[model samples]
Target: MDDRRGSVLVLTNLHDVTTDIVLRVLAARRVPVVRLDPGTDLLAEASLSASYGTGGQRGTLRTPSRDLDLTRVRSVWVRRPSAYDGPPGLDEHDRRFAREQAFWGIGGVLASLPHAHYVNHLWNNRAAEYKPAQLAAAQQVGLLVPDTLITHAAQEAREFVACHGSGVVYKPLWNSPYRVAGRPHSVWVREVREQEITEAVAVCPHLFQARVDKAFDVRVTAVGPWLSGVRIDSPDLDWRRRQGLMRCEPVDVPGAIDQSVRAYLAHFRLVYGAFDFAVTHDGTWYFLECNPNGQWAWQPPDVTDAIAQALADQLEKGSAP
Candidate 1:
């Protein structure tokens, strides 16, 4: 089969503007694309029938717009798709059972698609999401990593903060959706003092790191062999909170940082990554966490377009097998 003739299967929710950018690029190039949300589509707006034998696995997935031949998928872009919620109406117990089936059944099929190139394979994305794993990988690749500690003990948290006399910051291991008083809440990076450590720290594992007295933050978005570095200038500790007040400009990636970025991606077998770095006054690039499936559409227009084009190029080329 000619891989180029196959369609690009996009797995993302309807409101994902990032996926929309890439889809537009694909459409402009006349690449066949089939976009669907497994969460809401499977068992509702979509249907599937797959089989396996001596000839290998084959199936047909019917989405609202198109019927995708599982064997003819050139690549899959696993974007921010919600979890399988099962069918619309069901009892709690039945819903749980149906969700599980949808996940392992249809999810497994999507993961097993032969000769399909995944931007960042779902398994790889899962492993890279671990902060511990990411930090270890960055250090192994010769990147400058700040002193860090992960603990569930109050005493340990206090000691960590005390030892880093310069300062320490608490960062959540994962950005799980949080709510306060019926309103969405975000946990931003904030300086933590030794005195602030309380017995509540023992209730859960918390991450603390020596804060880098940085000049600004750098967001490097990598797609395959392409890398786009953006210098973000903001007065706040976390620029994301006040993006409108921040200044963004395209910057050249340092040779060493570029090499380390590629090595880090190779370590996790990821074709895409959004790496964060804290650059100090002395021009040191301190390694921060890399979001394996991070958002890049929020970047400046030119950078976003470049990333979209690069991603589309990868999907169009598919994978060599």
Candidate 2:
């Protein structure tokens, strides 16, 4: 079979600019690409039929704009997709049931496509989202990680903060949607004092780590075997808060860090990852976290273009049997 004959299936919502960038690269290469949002599309604009037996699994997924032969999928990009909410105008219980059926039926078939490579497989992505697992993997792969603590006990949190004389920072384990006054808000990393660790800490598990006294920050975007490191100079504790004011430039990745990064990705079975690190004045990179499907198109033009091209190359090459 010709390796590049089939389509590249992209799973993402409509308003994703990152997906648009990658799509353009795929288009320039003349690769057949099928973009769809299964969450909403399955309710009306899409239909799926899959069957399995001795002859093996087979199916056809029909979207308004394209039809995908399951066996012919060259690759799958599990991008940012919305949750399946099912069709409209149903009772709450019925809607829940419909959504579950759609998820297992449609999602299972998509995941079962043979000989198709996922940039970051859905199962691996889900498993890698845990910060604890990421930190453990980084440490095992020879990356420096800060002294961290996860606890639901007020006394333990207080003790952890006091032990770190320099300082400790509080960060959310997961960035779930939060809103105040009907406007979305994010829980950014901030310095914490012992007094701040009150009874509220006992309500849920909290993540606290010894603060890194860093000179600058690094965002390493890894796509398969390629890596692009961007040095960000900002005057804020969390650079994301003042992205507009930060200065970003390409930086050469050190030999040791590069090796560990590749190993770390392999450990998680991920083909793509955006890793954040805090670099000290003496040149030490502290592993913060890795987002399996983080954004990369926001970087400078050349860097973004390089990443997009690398991704397109992987998708075009497809998977090996």
Candidate 3:
């Protein structure tokens, strides 16, 4: 196996259609690619050793089939890496500790890749994924944003709801898996009633925002400096909830919103972002959120191809001439 580091490492889920598309693009370019599901399959086959010394730092990532010199890696595309599924043999407590170590060990080392151009670096991605941080960055960059409040106090939530009306929506801090009826479930973003603001909210922090009275929603997937937006018109509050009921068309982004979006990306040092925007009836665009490592393969073919090419260019070119 080649020990060179000039390969694109893809961290992804078990069944990622986008990863398959991206892999095809890379293959067409004659680029070497290594794809793995870190939370499950990778732990068994992947081994990484990183060391720091007086001279410099060096590391190697190895699978039984191949070896990659960490210093030479061209790019690391960190997609949606799920949590570590602990060892099947260990007890819950021991398994938890084991998983924690693996996360900080292998995961931390990957995040510290010295020469790799991360599509959206893991640490940066994590910070930018915070909805509150996304909102703050959007507002700071002069983008119109709906009034929002994140709180754990029931009274505070009630007051905010009263202020924003029944249209105020409750957004999950993160869509983590919850066991309901012994089955996994997720809490999606939904409208909240003023009466729904009860002591139950005090159990944890909840994000509430004044609903953007909208005609449509815009999904802008930015690859490096290139931007592609899809205008989605739907009757649903969350277009994603009922995507089949929506009409998506390619649209040009206004210069002002484009500039603000560029600023937001710069603030987070992200090379790629899937930005969500709420467009009002009067054609005003309100910033929703930016998923630093969001999916883009679901976009229109032409747009997806462009994004693929742009990403390939970035990985191959790096920051050097």
Model 3 regions lying over 4 Å from their true place? 1-5
Q: Worst 10-residue stretch by lDDT in candidate 1? A: 36-45
TM-score of 3: 0.93
lDDT of 3 by residue, 295-317 (tens): 77766788888888887777665
TM-score of 2: 0.98
Candidate 1 per-residue lDDT, tens place, 80-133, comes to 888899776799999999999989888888888988999878889999999999
Q: What is the lDDT of residue 65 in candidate 2?
A: 80
Model 2: per-residue Cα lDDT over 18-54, one tens digit each:
9999899999989999888889887877888888999
Candidate lDDT values, in order: 0.92, 0.92, 0.82
TM-scores, each model vs. reference: 0.98, 0.98, 0.93
Give model 1's TM-score versus the native structure.
0.98
Candidate 2 deviant stretches above 4 angstroms: none
Regions of candidate 1 where Cα sits further than 4 Å from its true position: none
